[model samples]
Target: MTRPEAPHALAITFFYYRDLPRAMQFYEDIIGLPLAIDQGWCKIYQICPGAHVGLVDETRGMNKWSAQKPVQLCIRVVDVNAWYAYAREHALDGLSELFENDQLGIRAFVFHDPEGYQIEIQSATRAGA
Candidate 1:
């Protein structure tokens, strides 16, 4: 069968949390993402032009909160150093030293959110990376 027609408009990745308000605050105040959509039980924040992340209340959401998070959220930015500095200043949980990956052509670091979700911030180090 042929692929479906029509281009996708936007993309969103949802993460469930026991405390929706706290998660919302972290994404809004700490991560500096603006709220795009606000459903009573879920809040969607815009990460960039077309990318978003949704914060959901575990009790009411499709998935329940779990301590073992097997997934990570990665975001590519123009200045990884600046972001790293911000992370350090905030004393973010599970903060890691910034490092370079030549194979990936990126300078990156990672930190955990309030509920232990790993978030990676990276910047391309070479052209077309």
Candidate 2:
């Protein structure tokens, strides 16, 4: 007898935001995602190992996310300090408070996008992480 296979997801969402260049910098420089696909104006970057972070030109979509909300992607990272420092250096707007979890002993901070959406940067615990 053979075991059934589990279905694979279609990767992460391809986020569309305003100003492709600004969005590109946020994802590539701040969030540290590598550029995987770039067709000028439109780009798709690797968020995690297999997850892709896409930024489309929402201005052309009429009611696109970038046109409506523009910023709503949150990434969980391993080093919140480093992440916050980078955000500070770049003058990104976001919260400076760090939240600690007693159960998991993990801590995280939040950063806001140009549209005011929050991106959480979390640090992993040794074993309980």
Candidate 3:
């Protein structure tokens, strides 16, 4: 007998937050991701085509907020320098100097979000990277 296959329609990464409004504001006004879904206590923002980040209120969410965030959200862009310039203009928290990694074939910079989640913006340095 052959097994049935299921195809995924969308991808969403959920982040639990103590302050959902603040997180939503940062993702909306700063990160500029459009809201794809609004579930009262949860706001889902589209990062790119088919990819989204969901912000959930810890009080109502399945997971509770933790002081330490070990996960990093990385976004690959067409122009990392341009994004870095914008990030600098905003004076984002824990913003690092843009650097290149030959091994990863990326020119990238990292910064912290409102709740201290590390976010990395990168651009490919070589072809097919």
Candidate 4:
């Protein structure tokens, strides 16, 4: 028998930050995600069609950013090189050179957010190239 589908229409990943304003600016100005919701204590940004990232104030969040970050947000896009160029032009810290992974069949790069969360932007490698 087939299992029933979940009722959720979108998936949201939360990143707790000590400085909410800084986090919001990064997601808005740097990453260029559109603000979808603002719940006073938290702000949600739409990363893509049905995916979102929520930035929450540490005082109001379930957890806080620590020395050891336990989460990495991965955004799948059509052009990894374009993203890399944009990040570099913005002087984003921890930006990595684009590389390919044969096993994963993807080309991607990574950069750190204001609160030290790793954000990976990737694109599927072409079949014949």
Highest TM-score scorer: 1
Error of 1 at 119 (Å): 0.3
| Model with the higher TM-score, candidate 1 or 2 | 1
TM-score, one value per model = 0.97, 0.71, 0.95, 0.90
Across 4-107, the per-residue lDDT of candidate 2 in tens digits comes to 68877547566666677887777777667788877776787877766776677877543476334444565667677777777677876856677787686678
Model 4, residue pairs in steric clash: none
Candidate 3 wrong stretches, greater than 4 Å: 1-3
Off by over 4 Å in 1: none
Ranking by TM-score: 1, 3, 4, 2
lDDT of 4 by residue, 1-129 (tens): 888787778889988889999999999999899999999989999998889999999898898668778789999888899999999999888999889998888999999999799999999886753
Better of 1 and 3 by TM-score: 1
**How many collisions per candidate?**
0, 0, 0, 0
Angstrom error at residue 22, model 2: 1.7
Global Cα lDDT for candidate 4: 0.90
- Candidate 1 clashing pairs, residues 3+ apart or interchain: none
- The local distance difference test score of each candidate is 0.95, 0.69, 0.94, 0.90
